[model samples]
Target: MNTKLLFSIAMILSISIITLMCFLSPAHAKSSTSPNIVLIISDDAGYADFGFQGSKIIETPNIDAIAKSGVTFTRGYVSAPVCAPSRAGLLTGRYQQRFSFERNLTTKEDLNRGIAQSEKTMGDHFKALGYRTAAIGKWHLGNKDVYHPNNRGFDHFYGLLDGSRDYFKQVIKKPADKYKVLQRNGELLTETTGYVTDLLTNETIDFIERNKTQPFFAYVSYTAVHTPMHAQAHRLTAVPESVVDPKRRKLIAMTASLDDNIGRIIAKLDQLGLSENTLVVFLNDNGGALTNASINAPLRGYKGSTFEGAIRVPMVVKWPGHIKENSHYDQTVISLDLLPTLLAAANAKPIENTPTIDGKNLLPYLSGANASSPHESIFFKYHSGRAHIKGDWKWMTTKLKQADGSKKLFKFLFNLKNDPAEQNNLLNSHPEKVTELRLEWQDWFFDMPGIWTQL
Candidate 1:
């Protein structure tokens, strides 16, 4: 063959090899070195309410798509069973109880109550590493200025500082309703209109677009399907006829809206060409609430209780190049692990001179580098109730009021692997297991500060 012809053939072969390598390489190989983190949290959502969690009545296609593309933790749990405390644990990557944030603040008067100022939130950690951070939606951590999102390290904040709020502007009759009124970086926006869910989604998309060039940690917390049974009239009409209860129908509509907004966020990521390097996490702040007709079927107890239904929430994590598609982690994992996971993804470490975090980095476990569970034992304590989970066994105690107006402490045990519903108690049958769990709980409780605020 001629020398020119041989040179052309060799060049073609080289080009073909390069193209094949690019196609087969992991997702991260084609993306930026540092990953952008988007943590999307839904409030008071049920475990069985979304398409990903096997819901037939409430549709969540967008959220389900995330599950299909990432890893789903079937036994995932939050550090606490309620809103404020659970969020404290989630953002700080520590058990809230350690900072004396055990109970939910009932009234707006408890301004002093919030996540301890000493704890470093997810935003704080990410910001220190040069990532732009934003917190949107519910900011239940604290209403106090000291505990505000801006003070906690977020560059931008848009949401309510209180726990619950009316979904529509018309419903918010009082202009000075601190809990219901929307705020942007401490500025109260009394004239804000439209569905809060959609508004929060807009803020998230804007943050992503503005910071597309750099790494960002966007905490998109949505307060949907929570309380007041407020659903848009049009959305309510979309609910299936099979849902008989008016409240449940409203809940369905609200959930559907939430799912739609999640889809919008995901679409925004794709549109910006940031999906490959963005880590999207979806989970409820806690479990389904007792009101609002939210159902936590197959799991015993509701929000505010030390039961699987209240603590075990639906959690999904998606990182295109990192986590395998349609993966499921059945072992016990808690929301507290999110911070450490994000840090590990950013190739960053926890800030020095800070207290040890309770959460473990889940990347190794999720990637098959580590076979053992991320947590050996997860503990819970709230008010008069307490619970502990080690391996498959869960030991719990509940305070029951008697007819005579006295209170009695009741203890129960169950092997979640067999009875996730907690219908069958093995407390009497397995005294040794109960004793072991009790001792462990005691040690954990001993280290925790007492409840800092009155409920």
Candidate 2:
């Protein structure tokens, strides 16, 4: 054989191998390194709680900085009005009910139920892109070994597995209480000390320092402003009794402490010079808890109800060069979009076996590349309550129990563009619009795999 012919064949084979390698690894195939992502999810924060959102009593300068640095989403929402289901939707980029996760899991139910193992999380997507992944605060998704954070593509995990925990030492009272303590990578930490917020913040800063040289994704899901409203004595004393109601003083202090830690997180990013290269997202798991004295004023309802105050939340995203500084995007966006959007930013390719996600890539609308809303409609269902929003029109249906032990169905329709508070019900007057939105909700609800959707 001719030597020239052999060399030609060798070069052809080498080129083919390189092309296949690129196709297999999309992350490394990109010309430039993708930015780091830091997702900060606060527990039960009200729509008007942040300083940037006109909170007169609670000062949140650091949380407000996120809005100042990038885009503040005035019409953001989560899939569910509660914790477990909402977190499931956010983490998996899909409607939780699509996989039988429609309601908050009880402590016993959590042992057997969670975000399914087949569902790939945002951490799984980022990990495929060669980015270090860590889940810092709350991990209410599940307590079983299969649903653990480490098993879900997170390289590091520091938090509790249950819905809530004590800020200081978590003493196991009942058998169910065993799932509520702090842990590092799934192992219980016996000597955990300090306030939960501060300790979590320290771990976050340390994680950033350790991985400053590489791209990473930090999911900081804080349990702040939640129940067991324990706050440091100093923070409580700082608030004057005359400025606000005595009942709300502790919640205010807890919120203040959370704000201070947020400041620490931002400062750490700046110190490591990772600010410009990092995409920071700050939002709430759901709406505020009215019983907790959270001020969700101007918006009706509270945390477990299907009202504007329960689903709609404050979302701020800061990406230095990509998103405009201090801009406000009024279009509706949901927690389901976070994974797809983050993976797109990371240049990560979707796997063939991964389940289909309901979220859209929000970059086009968020960056002005597209001028329309990210979604045409959003739907929610928890027990006997159901809600749907299309454009500016909103429809809600609830089952009220009567004194005779019977249930009554009440429907409401409101034009959110004009009445953001949902004060009036137009279901009778706008029968046509009511039928349209209700039909849409029925289609979505029935399509879900949960038991509640069986009918």
Strongest candidate by TM-score: 2
Model 2 regions more than 4 Å off: 1-32, 400-408, 452-455
Best by lDDT: 1
lDDT of each: 0.88, 0.87
Clashing pairs in 2: none
Q: How well is each residue in 102-165 modelled by candidate 1, as lDDT tens digits?
A: 8787754566788887788888888877788999998888777888899998999999987778
Error of 1 at 444 (Å): 1.0
* Alpha-carbon TM-score of each model against the true structure: 0.90, 0.92
Clashing pairs in 1: none
TM-score of model 2 (CA atoms) = 0.92
The sequence of per-residue lDDT tens digits that candidate 2 reaches over residues 328-386 is: 99999999998888878876656557889889888889878999899999999888789
- What candidate 1 gets wrong by more than 4 Å, as runs, is 1-31, 107-109, 170-176, 400-408, 453-455
